[model samples]
Target: MQTAVLSSRSLRIALPLAAALTLVACAPMSTMYSQDSLPDAVKVPAGNKVVLQTVGVGEILYECRAKKDMPGQFEWTFVGPDAVLKDRSGMQVGRYYGPPATWESSDGSKVTGAQVAVAPAGTGNIPHQLVKANPATGMGAMTQTTYIQRVATKSGVAPADRCDMGSAGAKQKVGYQADYIFWKAS
Candidate 1:
């Protein structure tokens, strides 16, 4: 259809539709955060660099335990995560867990991070965080993982009803997804 032959009414609709499509095409894709926009913390020295970026899928386990120093009271205590870490192609490549939140690779290399900062990920969603690694825990592919950032988390919390003393020893496994960015020390 030649543009010069279009009817006035048709042109009116087509012009605006075309413009809208053009704008949409040029818009940036939205994500939990981009590198520059990600949360920052002094604990993770800026001199370090990215080593790996993986997506983790699994459960955030929890157990109801008596609150320490608060006799007769109880609370839900985190029992560590159990997740399969995958590369960009979605190939399972490692694991995520520990009170230390370590990432262990198939090659036997790993990195353990201590959380340094957290940013909320909308309501009901887990917060994203930045973490600094404990000194010298890497090997093989993880040779220099000195920092980490966990973001784009989804669904990993236990229900409130399961957090009381009556439910002590009870366990819950809630599924979740998040991006784990590993870093190397300078």
Candidate 2:
């Protein structure tokens, strides 16, 4: 009888522990990957412009580029405070040409892929916003939101309104701004 009681108690404890372990083993890994998982050197193909800059409280420098080879592709890479990138429409922000990823803003807005744009060399400040936070890890967490504004410019040859837009507006020449916000994680 004592043996039966002890066996039942052990089974009760062991079963839950085993089940928890199994669930953890079957769980999907985190989306963020380690730096070592990436290539040590990234080769930039010809006819692409690379822009590197530092933003946010930590001054995290990021390497970004606009490539003509892909014909309508933009890429950006940055490391900074833990943040949630968003758009003016309150959608989660994402890359212009990379993965088919989506994000949701804190306000529960769905950010899509049609709100991003790349500007020429002489375009105005690419309006961008970054929300900074610090996760438990020492590394600062940052969320960056970017958008291009539609501006009407008058050209001597054609006296018409040239509106600039994101990917949705290809033929327009609108202005864009980059806005950033900072928040400390408790």
Best by lDDT, which number? 1
lDDT of 2 by residue, 72-177 (tens): 5544333222223444343444321122223333333322233233222222332222211112212122232232121221111111332222432223222222
**Candidate 2: residue 138 Cα off by (Å):** 40
C-alpha lDDT (0 to 100) for residue 115 of candidate 1: 74
Using Cα atoms with residue i matched to residue i, what is each candidate's TM-score against the true structure?
0.73, 0.22
Write model 1 residue lDDT over 64-143, tens digit each, in one string.
89999999998878788989998766667789887667788878887776777888776766788887777545467666
Evaluated at residue 64, the lDDT of candidate 2 is 38
Name the TM-score of candidate 2: 0.22
Clash number for each model: 0, 25
Q: Candidate 2 overall Cα lDDT vs. reference?
A: 0.30
